[model samples]
Structure formats: C-alpha cells, structure tokens
Target: MKTFKVVVTDWEFENLQYEEAVLQDKRIELVKAQCRTEEEMIKVCRDADALINQYAPISKKVIDALENCKVITRYGVGVNTIDLEAAAYKGICVANVPDYCMDEVADHALALLLSWTRKVTLANAYIKEDKWDFKVTRPIYRLRGRTLGLVGFGKIPQSLAEKVKPLGLEVIAYDPYCPKETADEFGVLLVSLEALCEQADIISVHTPLTEGTKGMISKAQFDVMKEEALIINTSRGPVIDEEALIEALQNKKIAGAALDVVEEEPIRSDHPFLEMENVILTPHAAWYSEEAEKEMRSKAAMGVADVLLHQQYPKYLVNKEVKETTRLNESLDQERYALLTK
Candidate 1:
C-alpha cells in the first residue's frame, strides 16, 4: 500500500486540473513545479516515483540523483528534453504522447503555407496600411501543378497531404526513412532530399530534432532551392540553419520563409527575420487547441498513473528498446506480465 509520488517537472498549462483528475483514483501524490535547470530538477524530482515533463532538462545528472523514479512521460510528441538513453540505462520507462496535436499542427502548417503561397498575410497587411491598390501584391502564382515538398512524411504530414490534396498541389516528400508505399497512399511521391529542394515551389518541414536532423536543411539544401521557392517550418527551428536561411533570404536565393518555430525560443528583438517582409513568423504555437491541450495533459498523467499503478502496458513507450529492462515490468509477477515486453 505504498503511495507513489508523481511530479510534474515543468509545464505551461494554466492549471493542472486535468492531470490531477486523471491521477485522483490512483495512490499517487501529484506535485507540480516549474523547473528550468538541472539543479532545480534534481532538487524537486529526487523523490519522485514518476514524472510528467515539458521543456525541463532531465539530464544525466538529474537522472542519477533520483532515488526512486520509474517513469518519465512527456506532455507532447517530442522527448528531446529527456535523456532517454540515461533513463533507459537506469531501468526507467520513457513514454510520450506521440499522437496528440497531429491535426492541429497539420492545419497550422497548411495555414502558413497558404499565407506565403497566396500572399494572404502580406495582402492583409498591405490593406491595413491604407494602401487599397490590388496591383501592389503581384506575381501570385497558382498552387495547382506546383510541387509541395514535405520534409517528413510522418503523422502530421500525412494529415497535411490529405488536407492539401484537393488544393491542386502536387505533393512530394523527402524522408529517407518513410516507406514509399506510405507516401503513395496519400498521392505523395517520395524523392531524395535534394530533388525535393530543386523541384518544390513550397517546402514545409516536419522533421523532429535529432542529432542527424539538427541542421538537415542547411546551406547545402538552401543552395539547391529555386529562387521563387518559399519554405515553411512548423517543426523544430534548428532543422534549418538560421544563418543560412537569413543569407538565402537576404541574397534573394529563396523567395521567403514562414516559420512557427525558431532555432532559439523567444527570438531576440534584433533578429534579422523581423526586418524581412518576405518572412512570416509565429510563436511556436502549432500544437495548440483547447482539445489538444486537455488530451495531452490527461494522457501524459495517465501514462504516469499506468506505470505506477501497474495498469495495462504503457500505450506510448518512447524507449521501447528498454521495455524488457524497465523496473515496472521487472517488478510485476503476474503471469500475464510475462508478455509485457511484447
């Protein structure tokens, strides 16, 4: 009858009502904190049996300091904040809500793409400045028969392809790992990254933040892009080298860019993108909607509750390679638990 403690390491949610309600029936003490640094994480999470995280550094130092932690569940799809390898080595489970906000992000990305393609935002700005001349916004091209290059063909891009299909855009993708058959289902043709860059009228990035993908869209990629090509990045910012993008935009190497995420959060006042009319910027808010937030919070808390309470198998295990060694599976004695790793 030991009561386990689940701590929220960091969050931007206005309240913890959904998480608290989800864990109410379990014998868990839910604690919330706004930990920014590893020292703060180590101090607040030392005794936690499970943790729910968002944007907090769960580093090797913080992991080694834990006395009895078992699981770390993330609020969103990305687990870049948590040290997955360190947690796995410590026999802890790392799970995430991988499917939430797919639709919302796809919609936002499409909106950004359209804003650039149709000059919607720019035209609106032009009208507001007391300029009523329609001829001011010129050179608008038709979307039909134009190639839309998707940098990743994952869930969000799949949704994006489906939504953008009837818009007369020819969708192509550049995911070295995406199955060609998967792309074919959405009428998207998988191409080499270079080919996508060379052919696309619009390039929308949807890749994750991995070491291999940190600067996947750097100078080399930008060099091959068409002069009229526009890029949209709703994914992680560092994926496109900021310096290279600025250079490209300044030199007119590419037409423009629409970005939801920047390489650095809360871009500084003097950032070059601010002075560029060809660029559109929105705070990293692609994965927002009231429904998505509630789903993410509750599902994240439920993941913690499931592992701590020994409920069904964790539905969204991130570090699945460590499933066999996870403390939660090792401690279970039920014959049914023998199939846990499967």
Candidate 2:
C-alpha cells in the first residue's frame, strides 16, 4: 500500500477539524500551511501528493514546483485563483466544492438588497446619532412590484429568485448558458442582457469572473439602468468595474450598490468605496454559514480522499480534460482507470 501526503495550501476558517475528520486515514497524512503567495505555496507544496487551497494563488510557478502532486482542490466554486492551464498541462486534476454555499449566497444577496432598499444601515446610523426623523432616510420604496434582474441564473441566482418570490418581485434573468426550458421551469423571464439592463428596477449580479465576464457590467450597462435602481453583487468583484461603479455612485446614476465581493480584495484603506454612505460593503462573506463552511471543508478534503482511497473521481472536477492523462488515474487498474476517465 502507498501512503500519501495532502497539504492544505491555505485556509482562513477557525479550524480544519472537519477536513481532518473526513480525510483521516492510516494511509493518508494531512499537513496545513498558511501559504498566501505563490512563493510560499511553491515552497511548501513540493512534497504534497494533493493540495487543498483557499485564497492562495497556485500559479504556473507553483505547479512546476510540485514534485508529485496528483490533484489540487479549491474550497469554493471559482478556480480563478488556480492556474488551471498549468495544472492541466502537468496532468494534475483540479476540483472544487461548487454547491456547498448555494443557499447562503442567495440568502446574503437578498439580505443586501433588502438592506439597501429599506435603508437599514442609514437608519441605524441616524438613530445612533440621536436623529428621530424618518425623512433622514427618504424615498424608500415598497419591494413588491419591483423588477429583479439577475445577471447570471446559476444555482445561487435561481435560489435567490425563489426566495424573493414571496416578496412579489418580478424576476428576469440573463444567462446565455441557461436554457429557455430551465428559465421556464424557474418561472423567470429570460431576456437579453441589454433588455435586462434597461428594464430591471434592481440588478443582482451573480456571474463568475471569466475573460468574457470580467467587465460585463461597466459604464454602458450602468448607463442604461434606472436612475434609482439598486445593484447588488455577491459574485466576483471584477464582474462590475469598480471604477465605473464608483463613478456611477458619485454621479447618482444609480441609487446604490451593495457589494459582498470587490474587484481587489482586502480593498486598500484609501479606496473611495469606504467613504460612500450609499454603498454597503461586506467582507466577501456571502458564502458563509457554519453549516456551509463545514460542508465545504469536508467535501473539499473528501474530493482528494475519493481519488486516493476509493479510486473514484471527484464530484466536481474542474479540469476534466486531464482525467485520462493524470498520473494518479493512470496508476489504477484498467477497471478503475475507466471509471476515473468517465
């Protein structure tokens, strides 16, 4: 029997107890590191058979330094931090925990939207200052009868639509990847991105950050939205141009924006978003809940353990192109190899 070493490149959670419990095995050993940079990651990952990463960059240089790494698993849905092309070229499988925080993110998006709509933060501040006038936070509108435009109708946005249904919001979504039948099933109107921008009373962005979607919601899109429309983004930060969003807010092109993620995380202290009273910021914590966090950790560790112990493919393989060619899968029996390839 072969023993394997799995290194967690980085994790910000309070503990790795859930991961340790799931990955505990006589044949497997786990090492935890707080690698924040590529140099740190390359140094510690040299001897790892597998890596579970969170908020650490696994670049080409880091991948090249891995002596015998068979897999790299991300703790969240997006693999933007990892160099997928590099891992695929090196025949290393990549996996992610895609569904772990579906409900939490949707709930958070709605929470931010409500906070913005009801002026809860403004009210809290006014009261703290001993102001009792309702006019201090003026022009609050009823949520019902407002059109909710969803930029991406993936699982999280779909769940958001469901949650907002009881509030009487009309849901319209723009997702080239989602089929019309799927939109019909969700009872959401599928529309062109242009139409959604011009028509929606509130825009919630749930798209991932990709080459095509990096600046999808910039000045032109914002220009078309209603003057008082609220924008909520719980997705990647760069999806909406931060500079453009700041300018829009400064000019009052839109009512306000509630952001749980930013284009540049750990936003610099001097960033203009900090001074905007109309803007609500969360520490990129939309995908958080005690239950969700534990599930994400356990599932991410189990993805590595599945490939190593049970000879099963991961449930959410990111680099499917490397399945048949990976060193780990190739080392299995013909039957196991066939299963892994599938």
Candidate 3:
C-alpha cells in the first residue's frame, strides 16, 4: 500500500474522529495543523500530498509552494478562500461537500425569518427588561398569508419554498437562471428581482457569490423594498452591501433583518449593526448542525479518497474541466508507457 500524507488545516485535532476513521482505511496519514497566517499555510502545506482545508486560504503562493499536492478537499460548500484557478492550473483537483448542509441552511433561514417576524428576540429582551405588558408592546405579524421573496431558486430555496408553502405563505422567487415552468412546479411566482423587492413581505437570499452577484443588493435594491419587509441572509455575506444594509437598518428603511452571515466574520465589537435592536445576528452558523458537520466531513474525505485512488471523478467536483484534463493526461501517460515497452 502506498502511503500518502494528507494535511488537515483549521480543524481541531480531537474533534475530527470521523476524518481519522476514514483515513485509517485509505493508507493516508493525517497531519493536523492550525494556520493563523498566510506564511504559516505556505510553510505547513509545502510537503503535503493532499489538503483538507476549512477556512484556510490556499492562495496562489501556497499552491505554488506545494510540491506534491494532488487534491484539495474544501471542508464545506464554499471555496471562496481558495485560489481555485491557480489550483486548476497546478493540476490539483479541488472538491467540496455541497449537499450536506443544504437542509441545515434552509432551516436556519426559516428560523431567522420566523424570529424576526414574530419578534422572538425582541420579546425576550422586553421580558428581561420587565416590560411584560402585552398591550404596550409592539405587535408581531403572523407568517401565514405573507409573501416570501427568495433571491435564488436553487436547491435550498426550493426546499424552503416547500416548507413555507404549507404554512399559508406565498412564495415568490427571482432567478435569472431558472425557467418559468420550474418555478410554477414549486408553486413559486417567477418574478423579476425588482418585483420581488417591491412585493415581498419577507426577503431571503440564497445565492452563490459570483461576479454578477457580488454586492448584488445595494442601496438601490434596498430602497425598492417595502418598509415592512424583513430581510434574511444566510448565504454569503458579500452578496449584500454591508454599508447599505447598515444604513437601511439605521434609518428603518426596512422593518428588520436577521443575518447569519456578515461581510467581516466575527464582526468587530464596535460594528454599528451590533448596536441595533431591530437586527438579529448569528455567527454564520446556518450550515452547522452536528449531523451536517459530520456528513460534510465524511463526504469531503470521500472526495479526497476518490482523487487519490485515481477513480472516476467524484460527484461533487466544482470544476469539471479539471477532471477531464486529469483523465486526458493519464491516457497520454499510458500511451507513452505502452509505446516505450513495445
């Protein structure tokens, strides 16, 4: 059995028992390291044959430094921190666990939406302050009969729409990529982005970060939303302009917001959003249920195993072109060896 060195970064060594169990059967030795700086990452990853990274930046410099890296398995769905183009150029296959957390994130989005609409957090605060008079407190609206605007009608949005529909809420979705028939099948109104903003009683974002979607929701988008509309974002933080969101929240341009992500993670203590009672903030944990975490880790490990075994491309490859190139290279190498031997 050929032993390979796999480096696991940004993981607590004691907590990754599942990863250890997977590695035990693969003849893969695991080197656990926590990187705090770019320099540390480059240094630690220099001799690794494969990397299992979570929240660590695999920059071009680090990729170039890795002399023997065959695969990079991102521990979660998002690979924004890694330089994917560079990894592809270096002939390193990148893989991510995309499906494990979809349900968790959708559930979190619904939880946030309900919390904001029902004033659960605010009511808790009021009770703590000894303001128990129900008549004097502000009224909370029931979610039934409200319009929910979904920014992207992807798998997570589709799942959420199904859950929301039975609750008597109308679902509207805006996705340039989705066809009208697809939306109709889910009982969702296929509306324009502008229409969603103007008409929805609650808006939730579930789009991936791309050039067109980066900072997609800015001042103009926020200005068009109903003043009573509650915005919820459990997707990437940069999708919404943080400055614009803060301004809108401060001025009461929208009713309230529940954010499971922020532009700057572990948001600074002095951040203005933290001071607002109308805003409910969670530390980017929408995708982090215990079951989801375990599944994600195991699936990511499977991706690494598939690549190391030189098997057919894994189902969760983000870059299909990379796998094609790898297969082509292997075929050419076989042809050359056969020619020399014959």
lDDT of 2 by residue, 1-342 (tens): 889999988888788898888777888889989998888988888989999998889999999999988888899899998899889999888999898899999999999999989999988988999998889788899989989999999999999999999999999999999999999998999999999999999999999888999999999988988999899999999999888999999999998999999988888899998998889999999999888887788778877976878776676788888876754443323453233222
lDDT scores for all predictions? 0.87, 0.88, 0.83
Angstrom error of the Cα, residue 141, model 2: value is 1.5
Model 1 lowest lDDT segment of ten: 333-342
Q: 117 in model 2: Cα distance from truth in Å? A: 0.5
Give the Cα error of residue 153 in candidate 3, in Å: 1.0
**Model 1 alpha-carbon drift over 4 Å, by segment:** 327-342
* Model 1 residue pairs with clashes: none
TM-score against truth, every candidate: 0.94, 0.94, 0.92
Model 3 residue 67 lDDT score: 95
In model 3, the worst 10-residue window by lDDT is 332-341
Tens digits of per-residue lDDT, candidate 3, 18-62, equal 777566756688888998667999888898888999887889988
Q: Per-residue lDDT of 83-162 in model 1, one digit per residue for the tens?
A: 88999888788888877799999999999988887888888998999988867667788988898999999999999999
Best by lDDT: 2
